[model samples]
Target: MLPREKYIQISLEINLFYQRIMKEHMLLIETHLPSVETALITEADSLKISMEQILSETVILANGNISEESIESHSIVTPFTLPCEEITSKLTGATINTNITMAELKLEAGTPSCTPWLEMEIDDINRRTLNLLDVIISYKKKLMEWVLNCKVFLMIYPEMLEHLIREARLYKRILNCLLDRKLPEFTLCEELDFWNNIMGEHAEFIDGMLDPTEKDLKEKARGFIARFERLVEECIKTAEKLIIQESLVATEDLRDYEIDATIGLLECKIRSVIPPILADHVLREAYHYILILNHK
Candidate 1:
């Protein structure tokens, strides 16, 4: 069984990272929809707001409850996160809570322990997050089906919708594991396979969204896609420490690329429909993967 403190720490840390991410996914969907799609846009906006409220709660709960290693991993908030949110909020005409980012930045890592009441609070938060994810996951699937059937046109890609669903499911799974007071039921190679596929899809999405004139950037994105695809294949074929190491290296490289791309997007030096916050979001995921692989 997982220790109480460890459980609370993991629950808060995961929520802090993923709630913000899921909210941004909603914002992207909301902003990209046509004005005529009022119902869809409102649903997305409502989900986004729900996620924001949960994230705010998480930040308050996690202020002194997170681990130093997790904070140092840069998986929660990178230096570019604030600027990316600021610029993306302006461009998308959506409100992003930069205060959350600021508060996260000020978070002080605490010892590996918590009070019993805090543990109970985290338990409640996890349950609430699980319910929210269910709604958002259903919404994402509905959107994907509509797009696939050609019943609606969205500026967002169908694959992007699918990607959002996968992430929400992953978040739900993690919360369920923590709530159960058990470790995640994933082998190292299985975990690698999941994140590797996510990274590959991110590259594909970036490649598809980039302007045709940006040949060099597109080429780099393709390279990452191919590299991660190969890693995923290796993961399927074998469970080895070497594969984890390779994945770590690849993720580090991709993290750097994402950082550069995010900066370019913020500086208006890159041409793409990708939001700056989206770039930073992918970067944070890569960083999160790196932390896991490094632990292995």
Candidate 2:
């Protein structure tokens, strides 16, 4: 009974509704990552649609320019071959494929238009945004790697040490912040889950070393060191994964604590065990990294 235009509009609306649903559905279940699924079912439910869906797969061709929605699809990713005009004066020999890409994009050739157009430049804010993102996720992975190592340490060690616990808690927070989309340095939890599984391993190693027998104390110490190395490797691997996967963060992030006294205590202990120079280097690097992130 409605007018023709009304019927058409209704049909279009129905199609759009389906499109939105499909986009959401594709986003949630398609990735096949349980973490992503959990996020989709929880915090990201509202996002329903990913940035990719919102952006669409369509490449923007404006003012003889071409760009893809994803960085991986950019021409820079996969380059083709094109011929040069300098070498070949004849149009037959001249080709258009590779060289014309960035320098001279091939649009539907037409006379230059005088109509005004908006000009945007790639600048600092964009660069900083990307770099900050890289750093946050990078450090976040570092934190997780430590967590995994600590986890292994937990399974093997007899007890936890205060320092290991403290670092574990700090690292957990840094990861939570990354998820929450908070700047790399924020705090959400009341108590730090300080001390990692490695602390327990360290305690076990030291306890064994103090024992009169159980002669494998030196071997045990080496095992503890090897575990530490594994933990660091896990952290690095985690950072790389998060960056690649572009993992989401939780709502509340973590902040740094006033750990000057604790750090000093830790430094003293570390100096006693390791060379003064190595201890100093570790302390300085940690201090500088903290200051840099905190200032931002």
Candidate 3:
């Protein structure tokens, strides 16, 4: 067992580390992440709306020019007829050929070829579009692989640290009880040692949570949860034992002070001290953390 002063010092250091992690997590959520997500969503939505509107307009224009009615009429094509039926057949053919050639020339004159500059501009736009898509894909991957992973860890670790601190303080109180000659009923040497070992194991798990290079993290987290459940069970058993011991003390030959004192201590343990150490909130939070890990 560590000396009281040494334990207090270690507790203070761990708390400071926890504070730092909390600050970083706050900064990420409050400032950095939200701003980036908002900007990306806004820009992507605007671009999508604009492209959809343009596509709709293009479809409408195309339908107007190539309607079913126009297609049917165009399909009923026939050879041209000369106005003078009495004219020679050779003259009619020459006249028809001349008009057809003139029309073809006129059509050719009206059409324009694509300029080099326009082609270059289109190529540049395509290249930039591809680059932008690549960048967005890369960003998404990194956000998932790094940012989101880190966020889950950051969110979970501080909470884990908080529980560890509580357990540490609980252990310290148990140590105090061991040392104090007055409260022997609260002092079971073997039970205290067992709980201390559990606390130590929990401390090690917390250290792993804060570690950047821990392997098989989710597996370890599951193990921690199993151990935590056992710890809770042990704590409940301890509480039951304390209650039974106090209740079994026969009232015969006992002063009023002694009876009152016993009751007072029992009430304190059940109502106040034990509640904080073996909290429902902690269990719920630990389970919630596990869910988050599984989700990620």
Candidate 1 residue lDDT tens string, 184-292 = 7887667888999999999999999999999999999999999999998887675587798888888889988888899899889999989888899999999998888
Clashes of each: 0, 22, 0
Which regions of candidate 3 fall more than 4 Å away from where they truly are?
1-161, 164-168, 171-180, 187-218, 234-296
Cα lDDT of model 2 by residue, 121-150, tens digit = 111222322343343334334433544675
Which 10-residue span in candidate 3 carries the lowest summed lDDT? Answer: 74-83
Cα-based RMSD of candidate 3 = 36.5
Q: What is the TM-score of each candidate against the true structure?
A: 0.97, 0.19, 0.20
Model 3 scores a TM of: 0.20
Point out the higher-scoring one by TM-score: 2 or 3.
3
Which lDDT value does model 3 have at 196? 32
Error (Å) of candidate 2 at residue 255 is: 45
Candidate 3 lDDT, tens digit per residue, 1-296? 54433333222222222222222222222222343466543443343333233323222222222223222221111111111111212322211122321221222111112344433332333233333334433433334454445642222334433443444344334334323312223444344334334333443443343334434433444454454445445644656555323322211111122223224333342222211111222222222222222222
Worst 10 residues of 1 by lDDT: 233-242
